[model samples]
Target: MIEFIITALEALALIAMAALVFNSHRNRFLNRYFALFLVFLALWVLCGFPQALVQEPSDYFITLVFRLAHCMAVLATGIFFLFGLGFYLGRAPGRTWRGSVLLATAIMAFCSLSDLIVRSVSYDQGRFYITNGTAFPLFPAFMILCGGGGLLCIALKRRESIGPDRARATYILLGFGIFLGLAILLVIVLPGIMGSDITSDYTFFLVIIPTGFTAYAILKHHLLDVRLAIRRSFAYLLTLIIFGAPIFLSYMIFRFAFESHPNLETAISIIALALAVALSPSALRWSNRIAARLFFSGLYDEVGLLHEVSSIFTSTANIREGLAAATAIICDALGLKQLQVAIPEEATRGKGNWVIGCVRREKDILGFQEVEVSASPLFLLHDPMLLDDDANAGVVEDVRNAAMLLEMRSRGIIACLPVRGPGGNVGILMVGRKVKRRALDPMDVDLLHRFCERAGLFIENYLLSSYLLSMFEELSETRKRLEESDRFKTDIINVTSHELRTPLTILNGYAFMLQDHYERFAEDERRQYLTYITASCERLNAILDQFLTVSRFQAGAIRAALKPTDLLELLAEVKAGFIPEQGRRIESDAIPLGVRVLTDRSYLLLMLKNLIENAIRFSPSEMPIIIKAEEKEREVMLSIHDFGEGIAQEELQDIFQPFTRLEEIDKHQVGTGLGLYIVRLIADLLSVTVDVESEPQEGTVFRLTLPHA
Candidate 1:
């Protein structure tokens, strides 16, 4: 009974390991061979059950099962060699190894099944045993060669491998050595030397040791690419083991102690069901916890981290501030030494190419620094990378990327995560080494990738928002300018009609009078009438010239050619352009010559003419207008001073605006309010500064400052 139970458990363990390994990575050739090896071992263990139980009448069946089990053992040895070779080389065996294995398998299989290898099987003392034929020694010799060769390959690989690879190789070596060495000792050495089968019953049970080790390596050290899937699968497997163990024990107790009493057996079965049901919830919880710890040494809530990052980006009003907060949070959560967030220069709206980052446990921020996008190739990289990995050979081969990576490594950065946008990469996330300088595990890499994906979404949204806002502001300013333009057009129409009507009316009336009454009037009367008509025509011409100058400015047809210009000569021209009555009051004697400045000659002359005309219109007829020029180290300052009816201080800037008039239109009929407006436009074109100081009663001064040539 003990033997039967042990054999059943052995078959269960072997079959379970086989299914788990095969399902974990069915696409991998090494996993397939490993699983096939376990299945054959399960078959050998299962053959034990029937061999021990079959009656004398079934001797032929027992012999067939016995021969098939030994044949399967030889096949399993061959498969193990293939698996070991693949695992050691990190790939499937080449054609040469495959052909050799096939040839060896065919020979060994023929030898195991031949009548000479297993002569016969018989039942003795309620147990089945085999009587070997003369050539059976060949079968043991083949098993020793194949199994020893597999162990030797793994032992050599363990020496060459490093880190996780070395650890996995060591486990494989220890597992296969223990299982195969003990099997040989129990199955062949003792039977041949001591003429006893004392340890034969435990031979198949030793398969569990190797399978357990492989499973550990897969779960703990990431032996295969199926780590993610195996984590959950291992959890479910543990849950089953937890829920099944007590029920199996209960059934064993009932079968041995109370099988004859049907009522007690039924009660024990019910109690076992109740116990399994009661343990299920706790069993599942513990299983998940164990799997979490086994796969990830320190498990983190990835979903929670995602939610926290999302909240930081969405809830914060400022995008840069949110990035800083997210960087700090991520650094603390991942136990990183530092985390850097690099945004594009254009995204900052011409401020700078900024890299915002933070250091672990340090309240003082690592802060932003100017790093040109061309100098740092992080912006150009589209894929996330670990700087230390050989996979980054492409990055290291390129000169720019290599220099950037070298600088990053010097700063202790381990990973370069690109925050991608629809168009391209919008930003980069540089992850520093862990707190203790530990290598980043698979889980850490996965979390950072996912975080970068979310960060990409956040950054893209901010850029979109900023773009929309700038567009909105531009639209608003355009609308305001259009409204102001509408008001300006209305003012131009009103001023043109009023100012032109007076001059045209006076000129027409005086000309008609002179033509009709030329003979009747005396010479002085006719001369005075002719002078009045000429003055009106000159006033109309001046007004038309001012309007034409403003029209050229608005049409963008006015161009200024700047060169060395004499300040005193330009002032003399301004004084000469004024009417005889206004020019007489202009005091130009105080002005000095030889002051030269960099200015457009035509535009500067127009500006000075407008200022002198403005002073003549506003000041009293009796007061003298003063024009002065001063030369400094780098510039020349020219001022036009008016002492009559000085402008109010509050209206100084208003005087520069187009169509703005402070005095009553009826009283200041000679002024069009466009003189200073023209002065402002011409000053701007020549890059000159115009300044005004005024008091309501004292006086007003218009100063022009220009840079020297």
Candidate 2:
């Protein structure tokens, strides 16, 4: 009954440890090593059995099975060494180290096959005779080399390491070291001291100390979960296997320990009884709480972290601010050193500079251009790959891609997480290495990917919204311009109505007198009245002509018929219309008579007429208005210079806008502000380019250039 209880308890404990290992993510190096360690340890336990149960003869299958189990035990020792190395390094053993380990295992296998490790088995007087093989000594020596050497390596490295890595290494070595020391004593040292007359049935049970400690590390400190996913059924199967194997194995070791030493057996039983009685129910409960807390701590923290991030996402509205906040919060939660978010300009289809939208814990902005990402060979890389800084051969082979760009922007970062849009990758999320100095695990990458996807969508929507806002603003400005144009038109009609009404009323009164009372006035009076009517008629004609010109331009009804025309003659004819005042004169001597240009004659004359009129209006009463023709290689230039209170240099362009007038101009000047504006319009219609040069209080010149015929 006691043996059955021992077997059941040992199996249950091992099975629980196996379940802990199996339930974690398998991609983690530590979890993978831990899982393999448990498998081999169980295989070694299965080979131990009572002397009567196994046949010693070469013909018996039981003898072969027992021998095979012995070989498996030696191999398990080598694998445990591997696990120890991986635990400290956070990766698989390098190629050279792995090769050496494999070589050692093969040599031990050859020794076992040749009956050197386990020579033979026999039935001696109803008891088993397990003969010592010649190479059996190699087993004890190999065990010391692997197990003892692994502990020393851990101790040396732990002293050199710092932070959480140091703490982890320390715990692993202490737990594993104690377990190995006890096993060696029971299997080898104790037998030598007691003259090979004692065996330990409890050697297998000692493994629970190391196994349970590792399980606690996984749950409390988040060790194996970096990239882990373990199933439930696989863990349960391990329990069943461990339960049956230990019972058979313990009975065989029991016979060896008690063969010739009754006192040794009694001492083992008393030690076991003492341990059970000394621990009260309350102490057992305290141990249970510690175990349960270790297992559930990581799960609780993960849930809380996830919840906090979700809350942050829900509250965020603005793209830039939200990304900034999200990255900051995530970094804080995960203990990341840095984070950056980048997006390309959608307006120029990624031709423009990329928008470096957000960063957390970065000292400066990463000015990555949009073309760097767009034209890169790895632009379409879908998944996140490990990025190494100072990479000469592998990841940095292409410097133009997103990964290299990210690395160059900042140091100590791990991976470039792509935020994929419908039109492929539209943005980037660069995550820095964890503050713990470990590379981002697979699970960390996966979580970041999920968040980045949602963040990408938010960024896309925000960009679209911003684009629409700009378009609406432009439309609003255009509407304002149209409304102003309508107001100006109304003002023009009112001014025309008032100016024409005075002239029309005077003409009406004069005509009425001339038709009714023909003999009342003398010859001189009749001549003077006719002259007055003619002046009024001319004033009306000027107003009507300007209105017609503006209407034609607005309706797009004016088409200039370009033909060869003398530029000098056109300016001369327009200048002739401006009558000389007492102080002002229209000078045309600088222009030659036959300067030919490809222009519409009527439009050229109209442009010159407006320029000449404007020159007369702005010039001082005594100043000379110069009409000059200058020749360039491809065009003929007609310039009108005014030496009046010349336009301010800043207002030169504004003077060509309809109804725009200089503030310093005389209020009594009898002219509309539309002359220069009309000249620009006519020049445009005739395929002519007009330019203005002016200085404040000096002079103003309007140069109209027409292509040479």
Candidate 3:
């Protein structure tokens, strides 16, 4: 019974070790060494469980399985030593190493096939022994040579520049060192102390300590952020352990309690089995909670960090302050030494090129680095040369290079992360060494990536806010200048109207007096004086009206009063009102008499007057001004066509703006240039459409459409 218990325990341990080895094969450093460790473990278990090996014919098959498993383990150990040496030196083992591995594998294969390496093997009285063969001593020497070579390579690698990853490498080497030392001591000194015969089982226990330590380092130490797999493995093992322990204990207790009676023993076994079955659900739930807490600590921490970052982003308008808050929060949470926030430099050039906006824990004040984008020849992956001895160097260089390269290529990298929010790469967030100067583990990288991704969104939003703030400031300054200019324009209009209107009013009084009281004057002279006074008064009135309209529009007080009016009559009256002058001709066309329109009569009149007046002022003395009123379906169309030096197509759109006049026009026109602008405002309020078709030096046409009554 004791022997069976020992065999069962050893079997469980061997199975556990095999599972660990299988998992380790999927990893980098653990891949090669784990297989060998499993072999040694299996050998130890088998040596203890010799009865199981001889209990049945199937036991022979089991022994053959173990023998094959042992060979594989030995071969893996030899290869792993060479591979580990190469990894430590930061380069692959050269041709010499490959040749040695291949030669060793071939020789081991031949020995296994010929049985020459183990001359004779016999099993008697449930005890097995192996007779030493020709290559027995040589095999031990090979093992020593491989183990010693690994140590030597590790020593050489230590002499080179060691960064944050050095400590992790040290832990691995120490584990190997302990195993190697134990192996050598067992091979050389154990036989002398414990008689002539030596067995593999005695040395197996020493391997468990190093293997346990290695498993811990790989799973918990963030060795390249591979924590999830480790955590899952631990959870699986824990579940099994929790379930198996009670069963094992119950088996032992029941065996003792019913040792004297076969029937009692069967009854106790059944009861224990029933109890284990009933308690499994509770065990599973407990194990699940423990696993979740262990694996998702970073996730919980990130949720809190995201909230803090979001608050900072929304409340702050200052770009630098926002960046500082974001970077500091992330760095503190993730245990990073440095952080950088960058924006595109070519953003000012109308193309988005990235520029470093801010940096934390950097020696250079000019944190901005220009990135060159390329395609075809991709940048190296995490260049080893970039790593600096200082904790910040590797992270800084890695992040900078990654950010620049990603931005250039327009690809995303989640190199390290829980990625703060979404999965897309926002920007690179590099993490420096931990407090203990150790390299970032896989979990750390995942968490950092998540944080940076979330923080990147915040950074983008802050930058947008910053841009909007700048635009608002510019608009405010422009408004101030416009207000000042309006005041100055009002002053000029007030002074000029006062200065010109007084003379025109006095001249009109004189002309009326001359015509009424001085009848003896010549007819031609009287007529000339009357004409001069009339022209001056009209010109002055027009100027004053233009200024008033512009001032009203600028003050946002322009409104139109809509009323029904006769369109044909209004046009005829306006045509008759224009006095014929030398070298000026006015042409007018009237529509049907009943053609009526619901519009702001005053506004329509003003619009027509401005269009006619503009055509006359710009046209040559011989050019005819054509004004046509026509009735179209549901609307009245009024067109003022001018045969004059017309406007360019480009300037047509700006013609209606106040104070805007054609650059090519003669500068002697007496008008404030607000006629077209007031016309547009009046049209808009009455829901009228105004369109102009103009071609340089050909002629221009102004068309207006008002709703018909």
Candidate 4:
């Protein structure tokens, strides 16, 4: 009767778990593997029932059905591992995972079919047992590979997993770890080492526990996206209820048979039932552990977890992101409660290394506190030789160098691992005490060391790559500037040659006439010719002065001598330079007495002169060039406005560019375009700002606003 109950429950669990994955969202890779696993589990359970019945003289052809069922159960082992790989990776199984499944299933098939693993079932002590054969050892070896491999894959990705993913992985490691431990003891250790028979009754527990957890994960969805993958867990759970419901009816039938007869056989069974009821409290706890489906809550796969942490170096763009990821891995793998990471000063290229800040996990509450610290020689900790100091006597200087040291120690920081970059150590990876508050073991340190080595090199390379990219961009920009400069030089030479040739020709003609035909020529003609030569000389002198100004500024020979002077007086003088017609079109107010400024006197004058000249050239003959002055707080404004053809908005910015003459401006205009460019150079030299506002068909205004010296 007890065997019947166990068999019925196992059958229900297997069928429910199968329908849960296969019925809905079966297209999911993990679900497909899980569904396949359920099929084998159901087959094993059905076969076990017949094998157990061998005690009843005829266990439904146990020789054939029992042997195939053992093979099929081993086949489920491979499928379960594949499911885990897909579930934990949260992706489809790759070629490697698929190949492993095929290889394992093939080996199980050969051994089971050839009777090399389990030759026959034996009925003894009113129980059926599957006795091992010569090749039985090979079965456990296959189990180790599939089970260990799946777990390793989970660990490898744990660092990147978060929220539901992390929780799911944690459950898998814990639950499956218990399963593995039990399988080794029941199938390998007890049989191979103790040379005992394998009981058919206890074998179902291994499959039942993991199946329960998988069903739960599917129901919840987030841990493994139940909505996307396992939409039918509740349906399966209902099915379990439907199938296992007969167990209570059978119990009632047994109660009637035992109570009505009251024989010696029935009396022992009743006493056992009474003891079970009495010890229900302890049984409830064990049942809960079994129902919860994992012996440990947060067990970690050490090697895989370290791989997950090392991957952060290649995966994240910055130290902050990498450290955040590393923190999660550390907490999960090493069971650290709180973690603190500090970046070195040299990485930021500063006085001291900075604290990348702190992350504290109190219970499940995880948060970051950004507290920056400076100047600690903690980079020396990168050697991997340093161990935790009980009293911290050796690290007194480090504490002195960094004030946050005492606070960190108080918080139970166990080890300071240096995160090294190309330039020595980039930061400090400070870990706090373990979650269990135990000192770190050798394995923990070694894992950290390996992770840090990979992380540091990868981070250094990222920084190096970023730096190289920036330098390349800067070099490209510098090349562009040089090209523009070359173009400007070419334009200057063309304009200068044309301007110079015309003046030199005039001077040469005038000199020849005055020297050879002085007596023959009229006095007035000679005087007019002499005047032309004098004008030509002055024009040449002006051009030469412009050239000299350009050369002086370009070579950084000019310096500003700032002193208090009347800006209004200077503007009045400049306004006088541009004479007006009878109507006084060039208008101005009375010069203020104390509108003083501190600027290079000559540079300021040059700026004012250029604005007046530009205005005169662009404005029409009928319109006057206006020089307007206004007083402002802490500064004075001098405006040069032209009432003629207004400058276009698009070309306003370029007016200050050297030798930049607009096509709209009169081609017959007599001056070189260097006036405004010279003004720009002078303003920059003297620490003055020059701005312009203009519109086509309206007038242009050049405003010179300077601060008081």
Kindly indicate the candidate among 3 and 4 with the higher lDDT. Answer: 4
Candidate 1 local lDDT, 188-214, one digit each (tens): 787677653455667767767887887
- The candidate with the higher TM-score, 2 or 3, is 2
Backbone clashes in model 4, listed as residue pairs: 155-304, 221-225, 221-226, 344-353, 344-427, 345-352, 345-353, 352-375, 598-709
> Where does model 4 exceed 4 Å of error?
1-345, 348-374, 378-414, 421-424, 432-451, 576-586, 589-592, 662-666
Top candidate on TM-score is: 1
Per-residue CA lDDT of model 3 for 525-573, tens digit only, reads 7787777777777777876777777667667797767788888777776
lDDT of 3: 0.60
Please give the ranking of all candidate structures by TM-score, highest first, separated by commas.
1, 4, 2, 3
| Range of the 10 consecutive residues with the lowest summed lDDT in candidate 1 | 386-395
What is the TM-score of each predicted model, taking all chains together?
0.62, 0.44, 0.43, 0.53
Question: By lDDT, highest first, what's the ranking?
Answer: 1, 4, 2, 3
In candidate 2, position 179 carries an lDDT of 85
Candidates' RMSD to native: 10.3, 18.1, 19.4, 15.1
lDDT of 2: 0.64
What tens-digit string does per-residue lDDT give for candidate 2 at 443-556? 466567767766766666666667778779999998987987797697587566666786798799898889898799999989988988998898888878887888789788
Most lDDT-accurate candidate: 1
Reference-based TM-score, model 1: 0.62
